[model samples]
Target: MMLSELSRFGLDPFLKMRHMQDDMNRLLSGLGTATAQAFPPINLWLGENSVVVTAELPGLSCDDVDVTVREDTLTLQGKREPKVEGENAAWHRRERAYGSFSRSVQLPFRVDPDQVQARFADGRLEIELQRPEADRPKKIQIKAA
Candidate 1:
């Protein structure tokens, strides 16, 4: 029987713990998991003519990140690895999660891909996308007739 099936007998918590442990191990080892979800939470802001995205990604470098901008979508992919001092080193209380993550968001309006800018500082990644000139709202004036 599948392990999850056995959980019907009040062993669900234990099985879940075991599964989480295994996934954590795979993450720390920089291995990919088909079920891996988005990590390093982010915030998105919409401006009059731009969209700003700020992602919190501590203990990671620019080289570990990849950002792509399409007409109306933004994709983020990266890996974060825990540092190991030595082979005998052990973590006392591991809290931070490490693993490959991907996050894609659909933008409210089309953006100029060539004008997108990205900056990484203090473990945070900020992306700025410019709205296309044609997409920006234009004000029209009615003349007396």
Candidate 2:
């Protein structure tokens, strides 16, 4: 009754391999796929006392996005749309990505929630968070007798 039920009759190795890869990619894509072609490609870097997050947010002005920091997690969420303003021509290929995306990442250290700062430049949103003062290391001085 099913096509797979007849695979034993004529199974092609190449087709089977391609199908397997496609299935796996579908599974991973559901779990927050991060690809270059995907909308809002995000990059996160952790430092000793800070975490820097950079996301590609094309067509978004400084006011279109918002950055929120809570506990040791950093969340980036935004939306984009495709707009047409000029006379349309025969469309051959359109590769620009537009959609709503959200990503939350855990930092290596507890940050100062009140002192967090976010800036957008050249279509990239950068978030800089300061670590808690109490969590930073201190230097001790030695005394001679």
Candidate 3:
């Protein structure tokens, strides 16, 4: 049936088109779920003299993750090993993700690589980066005329 004919029965063609668009969007949205689940989600805090970054690394030890800083970028690399099952065990449900993952974050300002500090505890990793002395802002003296 023609769209005009369908509209004669109190059906709005625009409303139907909107519903079809919404359905298509909902269907395609799931395609990005895998990419959206970036491993070891992180939080960043920027301060006047330093920057702090914290990441969640559950089921991973300090030796499992690697943190690096260069110029204004920070990179995190890690691997999560899958749990070993019995020889005759069968899988019922598995939701946890396992494998190697890497994420890089860009900082607002360059950091002092020599002063960078990282600490891992309780499945969480915290990194502190200090701004270089030359990169800090200095106040200028005013001369009265």
Candidate 4:
């Protein structure tokens, strides 16, 4: 008998996406000393007139992170260190992500380079971009074909 990780959640589209993203992120960014190196998973969503990017960067402060945008690509780079200060006791097992990491994503469309906004809170970086109105698609309803 074999069981899969996704099978645990049954059938849920949102959950499936979340799980896959997590797996891919983890697989790509393995840990250095710890079990895993936190890379702050990211997700991009489209809005009516903009695209929002949210990243899960746990155990990281604004000072340790750097964000750079070039043309249509947004890059995030930083180092993650173990928060457990002063290692003591004979620990048999440790699992966490700690090391330098960077992630860059190319946006689908060129957005308002001036109207971009970013905020970090609760171990998450949220970036908002005001998309160009010209790039948005227009749909026309037809009563009869």
142, model 1: CA deviation in Å?
A: 1.3
Model 1 misplaced regions, further than 4 Å: 1-37
What is the overall TM-score of model 3 with all chains considered together?
0.75
Per-residue lDDT tens digits for candidate 1, residues 1-145, read: 6777777665565766899999998777765545434576889999999999999988888999999988899999988887768988877898677777888999989999999999999999999999999989999999999
Q: Could you tell me every candidate's TM-score relative to the true structure?
A: 0.68, 0.61, 0.75, 0.62
The reply for model 4, stretches above 4 Å from the true place, is 1-38, 133-145
Q: Which one wins by TM-score: 2 or 4?
A: 4
The residue pairs in collision within model 2 are none
Where does candidate 1 clash, by residue pair?
A: none
Between candidates 1 and 3, the one scoring higher on TM-score is: 3
Regions of candidate 3 where Cα sits further than 4 Å from its true position: 1-34
For model 2, the stretches where C-alpha displacement exceeds 4 angstroms are: 1-39, 85-90, 137-145
Report the Cα lDDT for candidate 1: 0.87
Residue pairs clashing in model 4 are 36-97, 37-97
User: lDDT of each structure?
Assistant: 0.87, 0.78, 0.92, 0.79
Best by lDDT: 3
Q: Residue 5 deviation, candidate 1, in Å?
A: 59
lDDT of 2: 0.78
